[model samples]
Target chain A: MTFSVEVNGVEHTTEPRPGQCLRTYLRERGCFGVKKGCDSGDCGACTVHVDGVPVHSCLYPAVRAGGHAVTTVEGLATAGELHPVQQRFLDAQGFQCGFCTAGFVMTTAALDEAQLADLPQALKGNLCRCTGYRAISDAVRGVTTVETACPGRAVGASVAAPAGPQVVTGTARYTLDVDVPGVLHMKLLRSPHAHARVVAIDTADALALPGVQAVFTHEDAPRRRFSSGRHENPADDPADTRVLDDVVRHVGQRVAAVVADTEAAAEEGCRRVRVTYEVRPAVTDPEEALRPGAPLVQATGNVVGEVHGEVGDVEAGFAAAAAVYERTFHTPRVQHASLETHGAVGWLEADDSLVVRTSTRSRSSPAARCATCSTCPPSRCGWWRAASGAGSAASRRCSSRTWSRSPCCNCAGRCAWSSPAPSSSSVPPRGTRSPCA
Target chain B: MDLHTVEQWVDARTVDAWRPGDAWLAGGTALFSAPGVHLRRLRDLGGTGWEPLVEDPDGRLEIAATCTVARLAAHPVALFGQCCRAFLASFTIWNMATVGGNLCAALPAGPMIALTTALDGGCLLLAPDGAARTLPVTAFVVGDGRTALREGELLRSVTVGPLPARTAFRQASLSTLGRSAALLIGTRDADGAMTLTITAATPRPHRLRFAVPPTAGELREAVEDEVEHWFDDLHGHPAWRRHLTFRFAEQIREELS
Candidate 1:
């Protein structure tokens, strides 16, 4: 349903689905400052002011934001004027990649001068992967005055102080504050067991649920697999994932997706989805997966690949050292917990091309290659062909060099015909070690 | 907004006028962090036109339930003001959090609860029946994330007696940016009577009062006997909490005397 919301003193009527988060709604409305890092509430990247109070937009339901004022990083400055907090961040160089800047600004703006003095506690919820928090703290402290010229000024500048009923007296608009139209709520049916093979699936009950619009299973989805992994050439890697798969590898892995008129309906549809699984022994421990007797997590065994690159011989280096400290530092898997959860809105064009608006790590590559090649599987194995082709060429060159080194080359009188002529003048002479070598 | 929708705001004002499914909105710091909360609606009880700060007629201090920690740090009360300054460890979101919010949120390591219980403060509880009752700060917090607040009741304000002429506060945490693992507050009255309050180590505040300065053995026994359950979490274990409670209790008692 469409609802009216006032953001930064402007009112707009928009439609929003119950499960649709405020962060996605605001981004769709062209507020790109709201970043999505981790879809979980751990990271404050999606922080925005809801009724003047700072909140993680990812956790708040868009429907709950109806008739409320939302404030984002774009609204911090008044008509090209910067709020003191934003200026402070700029002066202190509080941000690096700029993804987390909006959250810091929104959180800082919510605090008063006294609270700003001791900020470690106040800003604890807002985590920055970069800068180690020194500059952020400085920025928060540097902006003593409340007003400035634009949203990008230094904290030290003198501007009109933020004067309102109370500093955060409940009138801020956030991304979730937007009310959209014709929105459909979506939910995913996740696997209960860690690893299992889907033997039978049923979705008729889910489609019959009230307000249910669509139910997608592996049978209805594209057969091609895609890689969700984030890397430079994701297609070259083990792109083993599919939109919906018969085999579930992780407990939280999506088995099916349901779109409904309401979030509650979508949730009900998710519950109605029935799937019979042949549960398998799951391997959660990465170390155990490498052991000899451990159950293989993947068909090709659990070892993804080992990274071993050395500039010099490690044994020689260790032997030369008077004292060696060899210790393994284990870092547990940590969720990014970005305030904006991972979500995408996809619409199929009349031409059959899909227009997907999603928060993804891979945004630089071309869409077609990224979606089909980088994300698609089976074609990823083609990377092995490329690597082997280079290796074969290198081995052929080495064997020809060894043949040319033989003393029989001159006796047999086959040296000239046996070895191919150098392709360029830069190539070294076969008999002599040329300076170019 | 109409009362029907207003009942869902969850602030100090709405907390006082609570209907069903209403919970007090403190800083909205903790409540907003948790997803799928049991509360269907929030009654906004924040900044409800109440006086944020007030000094009592007898030279004591009474702060509004909605007053932020930032305000308390600058207030005139010595013990409370010092505790408020130390409480600055959690300052980034302090501007919106209220004194009552901190107390009612009832995290064992909550700095405000340690401060109030240390000062022998009392909470003014306004029940939905239009009757008001007062409970000692030590008795108010029942357990972690738990409080003595009855349904449809609100904590109006926290009242602290004037510093007993001389008072000192000491608190410690595990990390530089960590919550307190243990907190100790000691006060000496004019008649040579001393009171030592140990918190952050137990589910409830452990307060020991002495007509005369107590010995180390007496202090240790009082702490062990008074505090029912020692707190344990990611911050510190229950055994460590008990050990530090006794250690700090003796330190504060000697320092106050």
Candidate 2:
């Protein structure tokens, strides 16, 4: 069904099936600053101002945002000026990758100077993997003056004072905010058991659900396995993920997916689908998975691989030390609670190629893999396509080379090109030292 | 998105609209964090408007439940104001969070709970009917994420008596930037009746009262016996929380007496 939404003071009419989120809606309308790190509400990357208040837009329904003023990073700037928050971010070097910067800025903009004092508490919801947050805190505190209107400009540019309201007063637009016409809501039926093998599958009952449009099982999906790894060359790594799989290795592994007219209908379709499984032994602990007796988490065995690099020999260092502090610190598995939950909208173009819009780390390893992998070309890669679609597409290749020369050249750089093949002429000289060195 | 879409009613009528799947949306601080709630409708009771801090017909101080924690901390009263100022860690989010919302949220670490229960504050709940009932703050919270408010009932205000001649408060947390692990507030009335409220360590606020100021040994026993519902979560384990609570209670008792 079609719905009308007012975003950043402009009214736009779009169609979205029930369950369509506001994050996707905003991205489709060209508010590309909203990043999607985690699809769950934990990460504040998708935070936007809905009705002038900062909120994680990933979980909010597009229907819920109807008739509301949605302000995104795009809305933060108006009439060729930078919002004070954005300018402060630039001055403070608050962002490295710039993926989480928009969300951080939007969240900070929502807070007054007094609330900004509690930087750790206010930013607890927004997670940044880079720059360590010292700069972000500075930026939030630096923007003392409140603006009465949006300061319009390209976010990367330095501009004068913001003209908008000081406090973030409404629900913000995020990646899941996109509203597409005739879009179908999709839900994945995850495996309940951590480890199991499918004996038989049936979707006949699920297909009978009134609003169910399509049901995809292992047989209906492409046999090729794709990896969700955020690496530059995925082919160099393992492509272990599949749209649907008969063997479930994890609790949240997708077994089937259903598309329906409404989220409720999709949920019902997922519930109706039945499958017989042969339960198998499972290893939940990372430590046990390394032991010989433990059940393997993957067919390759439980060891996901290890990184062992030493600046100096630890045994010799310990022998030389007067005192050695030996302790094993355990860091628990933490979810990147990005306010905007992960979501993607995919539809077939006129040429029959699938066009998907999602919030993903730009210039990530996976994007590089898409560029190099034969099966999935760079043109089809989501990040590459998105970057190329925007202006200054040619600079992407130049930046990719520059990125490789300085850093590990993984997905962290803005370069859209795939990593050069080992045999390619573009490979840097073997003796050449990296800029970081 | 539209707060105006939800009709606003006065205190009594608003409580009557509460339903199984409905949530009471106050300042939207906690509710906005987890929007996955099943509640389709929210009862916005924040617009009840501000009520004066009154020295009621009885000498007790009546703080409107809708009063923000920032206001409570900034109030002219010495003891209450001191507790409120200490409660202000960087979370000015408390500026908008109402007294009723913090209590209803029922977090053991709620700063307001530490302040109110210490001063012997009682909750004034407006039931689904027009009737009103008052309960001591200690009995109001049953456990973590639980409260004694019946369905369709609303907390209108909190009534606290004039602080006893001597009062003192102490609180500690794991990290400088973390939630409270233990909060202790001690008060000794003019009659020398001493009351110590131990919060954050347990699921519910634990109050230990003595006819007169108790020795450190006597206060420790009362605290150990009264705080049966010890909290053990990611913030802290029960053992540490218990130990810290005991240590702080003793410190508070000595300082207050």
Error of 1 at B142 (Å): 2.4
Which tens-of-lDDT digit does each residue in B1-257 have in candidate 1? 00112113333443244556566655455555444324556655544777777777786667788787767776766766666655533343454456887898788778788888877888999887769999988889878888899887879998887668688677777776567788888889999989888778777676788999888888777776787788888888888877777777777877877
To one decimal, what is the Cα RMSD in angstroms of model 1 from the true structure?
Answer: 15.9
lDDT of each: 0.60, 0.61
Give me the overall lDDT of model 2. 0.61
lDDT of 2 by residue, B58-93 (tens): 678887777776677667667665555444233234
The top-ranked prediction according to DockQ is 2
Please write out the lDDT profile of model 2 over residues A20-132, one tens digit for every residue: 45666676676656665554455567778878877666645455566678988878887867887777776565654455777788888888665577677667667776557
Indicate the residue-level lDDT of A80 in model 1.
Answer: 60
lDDT of 1 at B97: 56
What CAPRI-style quality would you assign to candidate 1? incorrect
Q: Which 10-residue span in candidate 2 chain A carries the lowest summed lDDT?
A: A428-437
